[model samples]
Target: MKRFLSQKINSIILGILVMISATLFLTTNGDATIFHVAKTGKDSNSGSEISPFQTIKRGIKDLTAGDTLLVHAGTYAEHFFSWETSIPNGKSWEKPITIAAHPGDSVQITPGGGKAFFWITDPQAKYLVIDGFIIDGQNQAYHGFKFQSGPTHIRVQNTEIKNTKYSAILVSIPPDYNGPSPNTYHEFINLHVHHNGSSIKDHGFYIQSSHNLVENGIFHHNMGNGGKFFQASLSGVANYNIARNNVFHNNSQSGKWSCGLILSSGEGNMGYNNIAYGNYAGLCILHRVTNARLFNNISYENENYGIYVGIASTENSYVENNTVYKNGVYGIFIGDDAKNTKITNNISYLNGNNSSDKNIGLQKQTGTIISHNLTSDPLFQNAQEKDFRLKEKSPAIDKGEAINLISKDFSNTPRPQGASYDIGAFEDIPQIDNIPPGIPQRLRLIN
Candidate 1:
């Protein structure tokens, strides 16, 4: 009888422990509470859909880790919504705090006056996601979104930022920051940033952070470079970042020394599958940049060189498999002091007015390797319509040196569809039979 009583007691204790463990797990990683904000709502109400908050500030104040603030369709005229260290950060990417527009709702923020529409300044405000909002700064705010002091693992996606006094998006680790690392692993995806900067010092996106990714963005009509990636100070290195599958055009309204995209003062920075046109310069790898790689890009119709590698010790850079044409200056210009540069498998034709300035221009440089580049017309399918795909029997087809890092083309087609890789951004895919041959109806044993 005592043994039975002791077994019952042990079973009851085990059940209680299991229940406590489950409760803790749910509290840590369960479904998040979603707060709603609408213009018609009031701040005094609970932040539910039926009793929503009126302003974005009130919605943000109640957010915790794994919480979401969903703003409804409306024009919000507020500014300087600062997200500081007092707010708790999400524990991980899976439990990130999110500020987003409700699905199918158009959320526009027109800030009248402030430093920024949104300022993310806290190093501890990590693992946050901002999505699907439109910010029009009306040339009043200094920036649309400004991130500073090393906030990591943040994502801003599907947002449109425009008409700010300075950069639309600025990510910098200032000199005063005593953080452990510069802002790292942030992502800006599917963004449209345009018409922002007021001078040459400003830009569409000014990034001084390291290991960030900017992809699938459209940057245009800004006062400076469409995107500028460089170190702001010694503490912010801006190294190992990637900008891919973006379009940059019509920037540099201040004129001269600006580019559609500029990668400077960084090592191992890469730009691939991008299109840059109608800028002062299409693409620039400049100012002590090391191991910067530009591949599978299309740059044309710009004011100056399609690709310019210049100014103060740009070393060990690689420009490969890009298509450049119809620019005002040399298609690819390597200026003085650029060392150990490799230019290979590019199509540079019809670029400049004179023959001397036409395909490739090399200044006084050392250890520069230029090989397998084409100066002839690359036989586009339709140049007038801007269809840059190669036609059949084009010289660029299967005439490129195979690059180990590039496994796919601009259109995400697999490389090496023929004897070798294609020479430009596109790989011409040959037609093939989709249906397989049928098996024999009656197989006989024949040796």
Candidate 2:
């Protein structure tokens, strides 16, 4: 019968090549797995690497999706340390679920009275990855990392949140979350949030959740109440979030209503190359903010407005090329419920306290749009060691106007280098004539 039907079609192609070689040997040796944790180990030991595990809640109960617990050197006072129920969701973002801090080893967690010293409500805690670590909330934790019921791709890096008694990172979204805005894509890198809050509504990084991302952080001092009102060291309320290259300083303490970076009730929020100083308002597009976008930031010496577009209904905002200086008052303060705002190519100088204030204060010029701005002296190459760059005969270089999503400045360089933009957050380097043309003028013998 045709040789038994060609040996039954070669035994069904050898059983489909042995089921594709056992699924490529279980996708290359069954992927990840690296738990450990040691305070001289022993929670019934098994988390290998010399049978480690003493508690990070038993190495997070033997993590599931592509695991990795690490955690090695010292102090893990573990007061509330989280994760009692639902905690296992990392089948994506390249198999997340990290929890690091073993590389250079200096762990330290000290939770103590714990209202939070790392407390994630675990609504299935998405692709988690809390790297490094030194979360000390000795002030009796009121929060030093607290993400409520809506975790999304969380990723806290390099960590170093301190003293907490209020906020040192609290990505909210569960005060009965009414559906929609489930704490999206979180990510805070290079953190070093210091001293942490006390009152005045405390905060050191209190994102109310949205497409979050706070980069290169270094929020300082963190304490308030003595200032008796508002507070912040980086606070975004929600909506397309993004704060870049951060470095707010000497937060609250007593600088009054405080703020060293704040974007409220959001709507396309975005602050760039941030660098506020001695806070009390060094960048804030408050209240019902809309279309907010403060670019190339560098608010200086604050103790008052160095950028503060008022409350309630803030609209169509877009303060560009920022570089407000020596603030103590208006260096940019557009209150009266801001409308179509657009203070362009900024470089407001020597703000308030004298010389008749106002470096740019408009309580409501209807549909505001102050163009080409530059209240002189943008020559800073060293404003007494603060070095605000730009000093090659700086009239703020090309006097900026260009704004195609700000190609890059604030140290990342690459913005019009010449012929165009260069008003604030630094983009100066295009002046290289090097004087050698005179040698060619008399060399006519070559013809």
Candidate 3:
């Protein structure tokens, strides 16, 4: 019996060792390290949870690929990064670095001068994640987060950037870059940008890159434009950029460009599942655009046109399944130069200032297809409360032609809930009363 007990104890010990090895492999993927930073800690000590670093710069100095830097709750002053800064130490796509705030902790990052808080100027820096930091520009800086040139696979999310003199975030390639390739695959998600562009004319979020994604953001109360996506003049031609599920409202308040979302020049850029309001123009497809697709959007209550596709260079565009209303000017404006465009499955109502202002103001041009459009009251759930959901028996419900591009609504609900697809950014779901059946008023027995 004693021998049997010894063998059982040995088996248990081997199982525990195997579990420990598996846990370590999954956490690090073999060669990663974890570091910590806090306000009260010292840079001289080892960057562990107990002995954290004092500043972000100190933590960044020691970060390599596959490393994780966890920052605690505090107010960070600034970190100066110039051409001489050795911040990016060979971060790779296979092993990216992560810098994030602790769960449920708030980190406020404020800059000191007229520069950005985080100036990533490295031309070859790639695969970095910056998440969960509140950046305040203090009205003395030009940018909150600026990537000067040539950074790809960079993801910024769950952050609030406000009060900057210029744009809250600026990503561009340097004009002098002679590289053969373009910077690509940048993603911005869940960002809140507001009250910027007072010092210089800019957008809330300006990106000059190709194949980027700007999703799930709130941009408002800016002096210049809301957001601009275009190509760099020297190095690359931006293409296949997408802006989805964002809310742009009350932007361009000082009337510089007066656009909520503007695509200056790009090819195959897409703007969908977005909502814009209280601006001069909700969505503007400006000069030199080709093969652009805009659908499943809602634009309402703006000072001017809801959607304006202009300039002589725009061609082969598609605008469908949008809900536009209550603007002071026309609902959708197509310039004389626009060609090969398809405008269908849309609902427009109560737009235009005068009786001559039609629901759609199409210029004297050919190559335009307009069909299945309704110009009646869409019977919104509540416009006063800013709720754009469709009411019961709304004309917009299940009245749209089926399209396979987007299978979901703005709220991520599955589409085609009824016989056909619904119009606008939202799908109408019939509300059900959960109360039990009431008793009959009078019941007579029949034989």
Using lDDT as the measure, the top candidate is 1
Residue 348 displacement (Å), model 1: 0.7
Give the per-residue lDDT digits (tens) of candidate 2, residues 1-447: 233212322333343233212222112137678888899999899977698988787787778787778888888887444465445668776777777777767788877665665677666657888777788888887877778766677788777788888887877665544565554688887777778877756778877767888876677788741111111222334777888877777777665686777877767879888777778887888777688888988887788778888776778988999888878878888877888889898888888864334788887546988888888778887676666778889898998889999998877888888899988778899778887755555455665
Quote the RMSD, in angstroms, for model 1: 13.8
Highest TM-score among the candidates is held by which one?
1
TM-score of each: 0.87, 0.34, 0.84
Each candidate's clash count: 0, 0, 0
lDDT of each: 0.82, 0.74, 0.76
Residue range 1-447, candidate 1, lDDT tens digits: 234222323443344233222312223346688889999999998999999999988887888889988889999987654444244478788788888877767889887766676677776647888887888998888888888876678888878899999889889877775644464788988788888977888898988878889987788998989998886555327788899878888898635679999888888899998888899899989887899999999898899879999787889999998988888978999977999999998988888974645789889788889988888878987766566778887999989999999899877899989999888888899877899989879878988
> If ranked by lDDT, best first, what sequence of candidates would result?
1, 3, 2
lDDT against true structure, model 3: 0.76
lDDT of 3 by residue, 1-447 (tens): 233222323433344233222322215767788888999899997999999999888888888888878778989987556564566543665677777776567788888668787777766656887777788888877788787767567777777789888888888767776665364688887787889877326779888777889887778888877887865464235667899878788898534446788765668889998888888889877667778877888888888888888775677787887878787778988885887777877777778964345678888556888877777777887765556678899998888878798688766778788888887767887678999999898899999
